[model samples]
Target: MRTRKSETELPRFGEAEALRLDAADPGHRHLFHVPPADGGRHPESAYLAGNSLGLQPRATRDELLADLDAWGRLGVEGHLEAERPWLPYHELLTAPAARLVGALPTETVVMNSLTVNLHLLMVSFYRPTGTRTRIVIEDSAFPSDSYAVRSQARFHGLDPDTTVVRLTPRPGEDTLRTEDVTAFLAAEGDTVALVMLGGVNYLTGELMDIPAITAAGRAAGAVVGWDLAHAAGNVPLSLHEWDVDFAAWCSYKYLNSGPGALGGVFVHERHHGEPDLPRFEGWWSTAAATRFEMTPVSRPPSTVEAWQISNPPIFSMGPVRTSLELFDSVGMPALRDRSLRLTGYLERLLDEVTADRPLTVITPRDPGRRGCQLSVRLGEGSARELTKRLRYEHGVIADAREPDVVRFAPVPLYSTYHDCWRVADALAATVGRAG
Candidate 1:
């Protein structure tokens, strides 16, 4: 068990300070497998790239092996005879996933990858009619989301160039302001069939105001949805309370479910049981009790499971179940408290180290406006080379976005304040060399 520290017990930027903070952190580094040093030239990497991919949990191996054993021993019977039967395997994650996102169990389901679920939800929510035919998204949205939305428009026989609205940050701004978003809705809300934005942006690490944006879009008579690939497991969410219509997220990032793990979806209860709501459905989506009856009639369940198009992938879901169990154990509230302090500590250390450098933090400084990530804009040099040096020489794992930005996400679950200090120290050295 880990000991809790009062807010006053938090430390400043230093090795001792990081050690102290790590000592008090309920989510310890031992829970993960930090990348090993290469040929003893450097220490274990100070991994600050959870924004792209999270480190694997130690328990993931055991969880997967158990499923393998079941598959070998039970054969087809594994669906109902194994320890954790594969037939209803996805149900195990529903409660924990709902807890992580602050939604009721019936409102959530774990299936498909992030973009696929978004497309699936859009099929139902993005009802582009005669006038309300536009789909709204940010200019800096992940390429996959952009493609999905644009393709969705084309699928409806609408020209994407004219029908898709891209909300961009103002002149001389790095992040989108909520005011700008609301203002766009005010002007073109009636024309928008769906308002889909990243809950936390991938490039800027900016946490958008979901409730405000959702309410604004709804007021403008548009269905609102969120792509939470970066926000889930990194911040506190109240999707139900916020009145968000639908949302989807991948588990491979902060959720620490290995790469390509199953994704989760949230469909607000208000949309459930509405027969008029258009959605794609399949056998697994029907009521389980009568699913095997193989009747031609489609009796979709009265829950979010009605959106599931196929049966659960038991192997892919094993690691996710293990990861969600950890979230359930520690809870999002405690994890979020630690994330604020850890990221704040990273910000301070970056300021101290880069005070004389040409780098600038583009991520929002306000705690409520961001998650664990801090995206720094590099000046006077190549970001790719600096990122390379940070990894090969200093053993710091950070991601570099093309042309200018380097992103560092010090996850509260396995990263330490000392890790934050090391990242800054390594970055300072790299920048000094480049200069």
Candidate 2:
């Protein structure tokens, strides 16, 4: 529903009017049944950290039990004999996940952790020849991504300081502008080998224009890759249609897989025929038909499965499968619709409560420019103490970045409208008390 304010009063979000969001939440659990330490009824701890780690899905437990049962019942033969056989299990996830990211099943696969997947995709896509040796990354890219790109440059016998270009926003701007990014690509096109960037910057919640960036990179003859840790599930994507060379993302965040759960990687179908693409391979990458032949030489599959280096951890993947089902049930469109409403509501509430306060939201005010997260920049020394008080006194849970930024993400699947109101109330109280 569209929101508006009357001629006199400020706009107020009507939680009751929201489209039965909680009723449709697939992962609903009885968190309120737990008794508080004070022997009072325990309220749900306004969880807004889906950008960091998602809540456990209600179905995850059963999915895990079924897998464990397969392991116990069939033993070694479970590879082929058990239902959803262990050997071909990862294949079952391919189509649905591909649909999620708007890629062909042949172009996607579940694999290692986010950082590991990034490195793997880099090995295949970041081929640096004489003239095309430089890499482009954003200045505000996540630390893990920065480290990974630096290591890739170093491994190629190139000085990271010279080979990796960190694209910064224009002076005094908090987020990068697409025009600036394109200008840089145009200026340095000939020397740039890879254009690797975060689909959504972690700290700022800036959703970079992926299709535009990909076009610039490809036009400049540079391969493009993306780290979707903060973008996947938070926004709609079309990795294939965008002609992105490759990408990787974790399931633990918006996908609601458990913390440190296995991640996925996407390699454009165009690369499937390039068997000679340099990759660090293992047995799991071998052709499934000949995999059990146990030959010494590896014959990789003709798809993204060729990127896998080892067997996936079944337990970790269980939560991924569980969480994905919830995503599938509600669908990304419905989930995102609610996400926008919830986050927009919270942003307005924050603005209202901090009318006379020192806190400022660094995240973009335009809904299309941000994810569900909002990063508030507090005054010096205020972030640390304010965050502590919110946790202990207000029954809220939010994360604080170093220096002065505090981030809160109101996940649509679990967080409610009242939670946003309470957090704003607590923040106002905390700031007032400190004053």
Candidate 3:
């Protein structure tokens, strides 16, 4: 909550202004642990990497320990006797996760990791037949999706290079345009079997036009699915209303679960009871009431739970529950409001800092087209090296992509206005102006 004095203070841009903004609009930073600075005069690091991984909630430790203690006391009985019973532990997360992403509880389930859920959802949705064997994704998609789709192509005995269509931005553009995507589908949609893309691009931080794209893909007769790894907790979504066929998202980032936490999947109610849909199932895939029958064959539910393949790790569910509860208590509408204000402030600071520097903000200028993250591409220095200098010398925690991009996310739940000012300050100090 403290602001440092700066000799570079100007009329519109100054650390004092940042402090006043924080005093007027404080986030829920007290609920989480802001890491100690590794290298600057400031005691706390300017943590801005939530797009990669979120800070741990203070409640996570105590809540996780409680789950552990239940096991120690009740042994196998913990399955039914624990405070938050293990047998139905995942059920605790269903509605809240559903609310967070704007889906019916029957249409959502927290299950495996992000990419695993993608592959599983693809099994049921990505049905390639005849000439419609192609899968569409953006060129800047996170690498895991590229691998998943490519492997899917190969599994069907198709060439990944040809079967996977990567939509690239136009000449000199850093992000894809929705009109371009829809036009591509209009021209080439019949050849595409599935359209899967990141709801928000990982590198450029572009929040794609989900509803428009989903409508286009469906109108083109292609199944549309989104990897909301970056969009889930960052932006508001309405998968059910969007008429999306399927979607998946990881919890580790904006969801604020620990590293590699379980992910959530959404399958529209329309797809739930389709008799011909092939799904990989296990005991957990069956209805809870029928789960203990021990029958040779499974009776899968007519809900999204039918996609779940295994009993989730209860310990992992604890952190996700803790984080989702925080989201539920504060609500996405409030967080998003703060996000727009916080990110807008950061953009202004970067505007001043990069005015004479060789840095370029690659994320879209429109707040409506992006989330909490702002990505900058350096014109001279290595982004990796720039981040290192920002960290060791200035105590700013940021994420860098190889070549020349660095990402900063001013998460509304915890990131402060001072955090944004530090990013601008660090950039100015580390990357000297282009003279």
Candidate 4:
């Protein structure tokens, strides 16, 4: 039966407009494999979960196979004989990774998991002195970071609860202001030994003022570090320019290196040759030239390579190499430009959908203060339940951060304006507006 559209019904985002926008500013979606919809009118899933796990690049599988083939052909000799030699495999990643995060090649190295690298960095930087024993972190830091810092305090014979200070957002606010962080350091600087916060917060999508926070922490005599799991590839960072003391990031999220991919770390060039810094070293920690000598006493390099412990898994590093190369070819400046346009389009559609609904965008409203990820807070239904409905029912792939938040990342590398439209369209159909 034909029926007239209700006048009181909420206005829907036009599919034609979304298609028009995509035509005008076409993204590089052809280079990725977007999953088919589980259920919906469209065949392809609207993948807005890149902030959680990015879509695999079309080149990843082939490049990863080439590395595996080298091992099969050359056997033990592949270590030095392979096309891309395995002995200095990690070195292949250094320059490009440095360029991605804006650091000097000597200061950056790709290594172990995010938390493992953070622990290694803390061994050198988190030297707690008498009365200046506190370690500060964001209240909503990823659980791995919280556990890592707490254990570091306990390892040093300090009480975790008393030693680990968490910075919270102001009353009724969704994100932390730069002043909030700077003021805390100004007041409690003397008691802090380290200040480690996420460059872009995992839950809220707020891009913290990295340069300002780093400056404030250093002036207050606290060594500053960052966990860039959500920031890398999402935003362009200048770690060397910002003078961050140390930092770490996982490639599995925005870097698209697959599940539990190896992470990258940065230590300022100024601290490279400091002798008094305590580092847990192993066979690989020795300088490259001396590594072959097999001496009882190691001669560590005057570079971040000195922090490496064991020979890294060459297989894992291959995927990261492939992804970093893609970043280099495309460049962060270009990716960030597309990210702004795509994320902004999504935000506008979300505004229309959320006006009378119980949904709210918790990420900072200012485009400068966030990356491509826009996290929405559920005001009524369980986040997990709502996301499932969004997935199977509407073919929209977004992630739920447990109790309330659902993160929608309009990744510029693959996501289309049409994908963004699908998200707001899915939510409007799934969750009815409130009275």
Which ten-residue region of model 1 has the weakest summed lDDT? 1-10
Judged by lDDT against the true structure, how good is candidate 3? 0.93
| Candidate 2 lDDT, 1-435, residue by residue in tens | 011133223334444543354555433434212112221123556666678887777677778999899989988898889777887788777877887888999999988899999998898889999889998999988899999999999999999999999998878788998888888888889899999999988888888899999999999989999999988888888999999999999998888887788898999989995957898899898888898899999988788988899987777777777776676776777767877988897898888755666677888989988888999887645566766777776677777887788889887677777667666756765664214
Q: Which window of 10 residues has the lowest lDDT sum in candidate 2?
A: 31-40
lDDT per residue for candidate 3 within 1-435, as digits (tens), equals: 012255454324688999999999999999999999989899999999999999999999999999999999999999999999999999899999999999999999998899999999999998999999999999999999999999999998999999999999999999999999999999999999999999999999999999999999999999999999999999999999999999999999999998999999999999988999999999899888988989888889899999998988999999999999999999999999999999999999999877878889999999999999999998986888888888998999999998899999999999999999988887877676666
Candidate 1 residue-wise lDDT, 1-435, digit = tens:
111134232224467777787777746688899997442144677889888999999999998999999999999999999999999999999999999998999999999999999999998999888799999999999999999999999999999999888988989989999999999899988898999999999999999999999999999999999999999999999999999999999999999998888999999999998988998989888999899999988899899999998999998999999999999888888888999998998999888766767788999989999999999998766778777878887788889898889999999899888788878767665664223
Quick one: ranking by lDDT, best first? 3, 4, 1, 2
Error of 4 at 169 (Å): 0.9
- For every model shown, what is its TM-score relative to the native structure? 0.95, 0.91, 0.97, 0.97
Clashing pairs in 2: none
lDDT of 2 at 67: 88
**Alpha-carbon lDDT of model 1:** 0.89
Q: Report the poorest 10 consecutive residues by lDDT, candidate 3.
A: 1-10
